[model samples]
Target: MIKTENVSMRFGGLTAVSDLNIQISKNEIVGLIGPNGAGKTTAFNTITGVYKPTEGKVIFKGEDVTGAKPHKITERGIARTFQNIRLWKDMDVLENVLVACHLRMNVGVFAATLHLPGYRAKEKKSREFAMSLLDSVGLADLAHEPATSLPYGKQRRLEIVRALATEPSLLLLDEPAAGMNPQESLELMEFIGKIRDQYDLTILLIEHHMQVVMGVCSRMYVLDYGVTIAHGTPDEIRRNPKVIEAYLGVD
Candidate 1:
């Protein structure tokens, strides 16, 4: 559903991403893998409108969305979770997701402040939808609990749930398994697959955990020093010499 053509991002003399091209089909889970400083996140930022690529184009669903604002990108059906857990510490689980759901609500601030009938109706629907999302992710019981109060893994899942609240067709996850234990990582793999089918989403994932990427992604692109080194299936990537050297230096 999204593809980049020769997309590159430069900061003065530094080039964070160079000639990166990726194509992901609808409902596919694709992985972007690389070691530290690989510009994986930079690629994401460019795609999500955080930064306009200095060169090339970002096309989504047949539309050229280069340099579109992040909110505009969300409005066009793209949502993302950051590499770090970014829960609203003061908001409860339900409130956290409710914030994102507000994006789809079509009500004037004045009407919402006065609690007009139309505003109330939309608000009720938002609450119900938000609760249903929480329920689906098994977080309904803790809907009223502070977002930051949850355990680390649950917090990560909650972040994803919040992203889903935006009702996006494409979900970009940045290091969803960052701090998880092996068991949690394994569960995350299953969770990733579950959500892909459950939400009918096309996912672009940036993950350092090799197992998580290989286990869930049908195709992957490897990067080293902001340049793509290999692109292939998990098995093929595993056997590629360039990928091996990128991760484990050659003598």
Candidate 2:
């Protein structure tokens, strides 16, 4: 559902990503993996409209979305979460997710301020929907907890729930397993798999954890110095010479 063609991005003299091309199909949990500075996140940023590519095009759902505004891209059914947790620091868990609900709700500012019947009804609907999204990600019990007060793993899971609240057709997850213990990461892998199937969503994930990628992703792409090196199943990725060289040092 997402495709990039000959994409490149540079920051000053450094090319963070170069000539990268990738295709992620609907309902596919595709993995984007690389060593540090290999430009996996850069590619994700470019595709998700966080950073427009310096060269080439990004297409989603068959239309050119190159350089589109982030919200417009989101409105077109793409949602993302960051490597670092980006929740509303002072808000409750449900409130953070309600922020995503703003996209689909038709309540106007004046109506909300006046507490008009339409606005009240819309907000009630949004609240119910957001709560359901939180429940789906296993955060129902923490709905009233302050977002900043959650543990690291729970905070990460909260971010996922917030992303899913956007009602996306394709979800881009940036290092979802980053900073979690083995058990926590395993639970996240299971949750991700269940939600992907249950929600019928496509996922493009950037994960440093081997187990998370192997456990959840159907296909994998390996990047080395911002170039595509391998694209195959997890087992094929494990045996590829270039992938080994990219992960392990080569003399």
Candidate 3:
């Protein structure tokens, strides 16, 4: 569903990702794994339009979406969550999702001001859809609670729900297990598979947790510095000489 050809991202003197090619298919979960400074997040950022690629092309479905604005990418059925949580801390969980759905809401400001029938109807439907999303993510009871009041795991799930509110065909999750405990990470890995099955989504995830990647991903790529060292099934990656060298310095 997504492909990148010779994609590269350079910052002044340093090339973070160099001549990388990646392809992800529909309803498949792919993991992007690497050591620190390996440029996994850099690639994710470039693909999501958080940063424009210095060279090459990014295509979603069949069209080249290279260098498109983030919102434009989101509108085209790609949504993402960051390595760090980006939520409306002051807002309720439902409100955070409502904010995401606002992107697709077709209500005019004037019509909303006067509560026109169409505007009200759209708002009600969006609310119902958002509630269903919240319930799906196991955040229904927390719908009225402030985002800051939720536990870290739920906060992470909320981020997923907000991204789902965009109605994405593909999801780019950057380090979803970064700060979680071992159990939390395991649960999240399982949850990733469950959510993908439930939503029938294609996910490209960047995760530092080895177990998380190997457990949930059907395939993975190992990056070193700015290049891909290996790309294969989890077992293949685990036995790869280059990947081992990159991660453990050829011990």
Candidate 4:
């Protein structure tokens, strides 16, 4: 569903990613794993157009979307959540998701302001869709509460829910297990599987938690200092000497 070819990102003199090539097929959950400073997030930024790559191309489906604006990429059916939870703290949970669904609405600003029939109908549908998403994640009871009022795990789940509201074909999750406890992380693994099947999504996630990656991803890539060191099935990655060196500081 997505491919990056020789993708590189440099911050002035510092090269954060170098000639990274990756391919993700439809309905696959692939993991990008590495030590801190490995440029996993930078690769994601390049793909999502947060920073135009210094070199190479990013292809989604069959289109070359290199350097496309993030919103344009999003509109083209890619959605992502950040490594750190980014929620509208002041907005209620349902409102937060409803805002994302507005990307699909087909109403003029004036018509929406005037509450025309089409606008009203679309608005009602958006609300129902958002609510159904929340309900699917067991957050329906908290729909009217402030987004920041939820516990840490729920807040993380809400971030994914908001991303889902965008109706994306591919979902990029940046460290979705970042701050979760063991139990929460385990639950997130199950949740990831559920959402992949439920949404028919192709998922690529950046995660530091080896257990989470091993448990959830069919294949994984290892990076160190912006270079692709190894990529294979979870068992292969586990036994790779380079991967051990990258994570364990073994000389």
In Å, residue 41's CA in model 4 sits off its true spot by 0.9
lDDT of 1 by residue, 1-251 (tens): 99999999999999999999999999999999999999999999999999999999999999999999999999999999999888999899999999999899978889999999999999999999999989988999999999999999999999999999999999999999998888999999899899999999999999988877899999999999899999999999999999999898998
Q: Which stretches of candidate 4 lie over 4 Å from their true place?
A: none
Error of 2 at 168 (Å): 0.4
Tell me the deviation in Å of residue 69 in model 2: 1.0
Query: What RMSD, rounded to one decimal, does every model reach?
Result: 0.7, 1.1, 1.0, 0.6
Scored by CA lDDT, what does every candidate get? 0.95, 0.89, 0.92, 0.95
TM-score of 2: 0.97
| Tens-place lDDT digits, model 3, residues 48-151 | 88899999999999999999999999999999998889999889999999999988897788998999999889899999999999988789988999997999
Residue lDDT tens for model 2, 5-67: 999999999999999888988899999999988899999889888899999999999999998
Lowest lDDT block of 10, candidate 4? 242-251
Better of 3 and 4 by TM-score: 4
For model 4, how big is the CA root-mean-square deviation? 0.6
Q: Compose the digit string of candidate 4's lDDT tens values, residues 71-128.
A: 9999999999999899988899999999999899967899999999999999999999
Q: Estimate TM-scores for all models.
A: 0.99, 0.97, 0.98, 0.99
Instruction: For model 2, give the RMSD to the true fold.
Output: 1.1
> What's the TM for model 4?
0.99
